[model samples]
Target: MTVNSVLVLGGGFTGLTSAIALALRGVENVTLVERAPAWARVGHGITVQGNALKVFQDIGVVDEILRRGFGADGVTLFHADGSVMMRLQTPKTGGEDLPATLGALRADVHEILVERALELGVKFRLGTQVVSFENHGDSVSVLLSDGTTEFWDLMIAADGIKSSTRPKLGITAERASSGLGIWRGVTNRLPEMTGGIAYPAPGDEGAYKVGYTAISATQCYVFVLCEPQRTPNDLPDWQEMKRLMEPFHGEFDWLRESLNESTYLNFQEIEWIFVEEPWHRGRVIALGEAVHAVPPLIAQGAAQCVEDALLIADYVTREGDLEAHLTEFQERRIPRIKGVVDASLQLAYWECHPGSPDAQPGRVMAQALAELVAAP
Candidate 1:
């Protein structure tokens, strides 16, 4: 079992972090292949939870991320009418070892990871796609879209929700409807909003809800979730977005004006999935959205992926048997990841279908759990 080189597919947060972790461990022959022409992430903003921040610190990129990202105190939830329902504050645990939670553009985090990986001598192949692979007992031969083949001791598939490498590994996934569609955007003018507040709208009048968090004194990240609807493919029209937001306009004084003033409105169809038996044949492993994609309700998508990177790296470094390592990694991760997926789906259902008796109880339980976890 030669454990000299590793090939990481999909250079997103998970892939990049995995490569960096291996590189930091003196694994020189680490290669990251991304389908995009350059290093960039296609999302508005992401919240870095406490657990993930600790992982970043371990990997030596916490400072870089914090320097370039926004530090968020906590999250707040509200009714569509702007009445505060719940608030989760970042409790100060009496320890200097605790890492700060951050909310920043996904691109910033990706850039920081890519730069660190490159500095650590990790090879990055942007615009390159992994077409297929053949696992020959000791090594896996990966074929790229550009007619090139390479062999590596291990392969990490970090491709997103619709991962292409998953099928090749014989892992099947089941999609769970989130019951809501989301529109995310950023506005230059700061709205009278604070972090961690989730606004749930009144009865199914389009089932609209809006949330705003101050990324900076001058800028805010805003999002609106409603019953799913068809959105034009073109860059989301701000006017159309405003119109969609019309139903809830004036419902919440802060959110109503913010929606009208926001310049960027990007619509997304939210869906959840749980891959049955996350690990595949010995050499190949899937992480991040590829293995268990959850709705953004919990905001732990990236955090969970970061955890996966660390756990996989730790397992591989400690365990000699490749099959055993993969199995152990899945065993430790599947339960937690599935818990998050279920929790997120339940939250999405609560937000989308508020009136259903089944959803209400789950919503209350989920809220209580969230409060408990967020408690300082």
Candidate 2:
């Protein structure tokens, strides 16, 4: 089946990428509806891994991302006392030319996507949501919160992990929490901090980690993992975040000093969901966090989402059966997603249980990076 019109739910990386990919492939009438009135992302800074950068390159935005973001080659691991543990070069999963990792403000990346989508004539409806949807034999009819019903050749759920569209499509995947929350913010960058720097400090709770990466010439993103909680808790303030950074030394001392009452900080509770096989039913499908989400252990979430969008755009635009195309997409993606999710979970386990004999994050990371270097 040939798709002529598409409805994309959510305006995040997945939704925008889907809309842009489809539009770039000459799919007309691609409408992306976002629940937020304006673009908003909690984490101010984002790590654009090489694989995701490769997708951005394909979609014609990598140059802008690289220009606006800070590019780095490796990550330095340090102990709580600021002593070096190990440092290694990260794989350039995107290719030889692109940086292994690029850091930029989340808003900057979102703005770039929005501009590109608009340039491609992708329609955007902000402060809108899908109230309901029904999948027919060949098309999906959606009811928007604006009280309008529209039909499309295809509908994509990219609304994120807590997607309302998942249940509507009969996907039984539930959101899973890692039982940990993270405090993150952007601060002035230090000249010597070239690449990603991580500090794994042992605490009364466990071996939670903290780190910072340069987001720009003058700014870097800082983050610290909090103690696991029995349930979701309230948002943490900058003072609380400072207290969490107290154990950290070296660059963290500067990071802590950078925090104040005026500084804007954001707290994120780690949650994930992995939708099972049959990512689609009829003409409606789910991608990105709506289908799979992992902890930030490996930072592969965005890349996986981009891969999903690229594959969907490629297969859906091709001639033949839509169901077969979707099935093929799922088949191609499941193994990769499984590797990322499982390895990330292992890393998360290591963080929560410091001395567990089963926690081999190094082995897991090496194996995962090796597997991910190949084309998606």
**RMSD of every prediction:** 3.7, 2.1
Global lDDT scores for all candidate models: 0.70, 0.85
* Span of 10 residues, lowest total lDDT, candidate 2: 227-236
Candidate 1, residues 44-95, lDDT tens digits: the string is 7676766677778889988887776667656666654455666665532212
Tens-digit lDDT track of model 2 for 1-376: 3899999999989999999999999997999999889876555788878999999999999999999999998888877777787887788889998998998998889999999999999999999999988888889889999999999999999989888878888877798887667777888868888655555544443327788889989988888876654223353477777777777777778888898887768777798777775788899999999999998878799999998987799999999899899898999999999999988888887777777877777778878977888999
Task: Give TM per candidate.
Answer: 0.87, 0.95
Measured with C-alpha atoms, the lDDT of residue 26 in candidate 2 is 91
Model 1 whole-model lDDT (C-alpha atoms): 0.70
Worst 10 residues of 1 by lDDT: 91-100
